[model samples]
Target: MKIFVDRDKCQNHGLCAISAPASFQLDTDGELQYQESFDDEHIDDIEDAIDSCPLQAILLHPDAA
Candidate 1:
């Protein structure tokens, strides 16, 4: 799957990082960073991260056709 975050909508709250530590994190500068792609095994965690976004900034897409 693919993960995308809207920088304009996100506030760097780190909820995604908390929900999916294996896939997302806040850099030392406090900027949000994450895997653009992820394994299927991480789907649940990634979905949790998506749901955790208060701004609804996180989006999930299937692998490109």
Candidate 2:
């Protein structure tokens, strides 16, 4: 899957990071950063991250296509 975050909407709350540490993180500048693509095995964690984002900045795409 592919993950996308609306940088403009993200408040750097780190909820996604807390929900999916392996896929999401906060940069040194306290900005949200994440993997664009990851193994399907992580779908559950990714979903959790998406759901846990208070700002609703996270978007999950089944495929880049």
Candidate 3:
């Protein structure tokens, strides 16, 4: 699937990083960084990351799933 983090809506809370380390991470500067696409094996982790976002910034689109 495709992962889209709305930069304008994200708060760099790092919840996504906690939920899905494989796809989301906080850079050295403490900024949020993520993969635009992920494999099927990571769907559950990705979904958890989406749910953990307090700002609801993570979006999962099936365009590439």
Candidate 4:
């Protein structure tokens, strides 16, 4: 799956990180960073992150590949 975050809509909250640390993280600067792609095994975690995002900035897309 592919993950996209609308930076303009994101508040840099760490809930995504809390839900899926392997896919999302808050850098030392407290900025949100995330992987653009992940293996199928990570879908559940990524979904949790998407649902947990308070700003609803997280988006999930089917992998084009």
Q: Assess candidate 3 and give its lDDT.
A: 0.92
In the predicted model 2, the residue pairs found to clash are: none
Of the two candidates 2 and 4, the one with more favorable TM-score, higher being better, is 4
For model 3, the superposed segments whose C-alpha errors exceed 4 Å read: none
TM-score for each of the candidates: 0.92, 0.89, 0.92, 0.92
User: What's the lDDT for candidate 1?
Assistant: 0.92
What is candidate 4's CA lDDT for residue 4? 95
Across 1-65, the per-residue lDDT of candidate 4 in tens digits comes to 58999999999989999999999999999999999988889889999999999999999877786
Backbone clashes in model 1, listed as residue pairs: none
Model 2 agreement with the true structure over 1-65: per-residue lDDT tens digits: 68989988999999899989989999999988899988888889889999998989999877846
**Taking the tens digit of each residue's C-alpha lDDT, what string does model 1 give over 1-65?**
69989999999999999999999999999999999888889989999999999999999877788
- Candidate 3 least-lDDT 10 residues: 56-65
Query: How well does model 4 score by local distance difference test?
Result: 0.93
lDDT, candidate 1, at 21: 94
lDDT of 2 at 43: 85
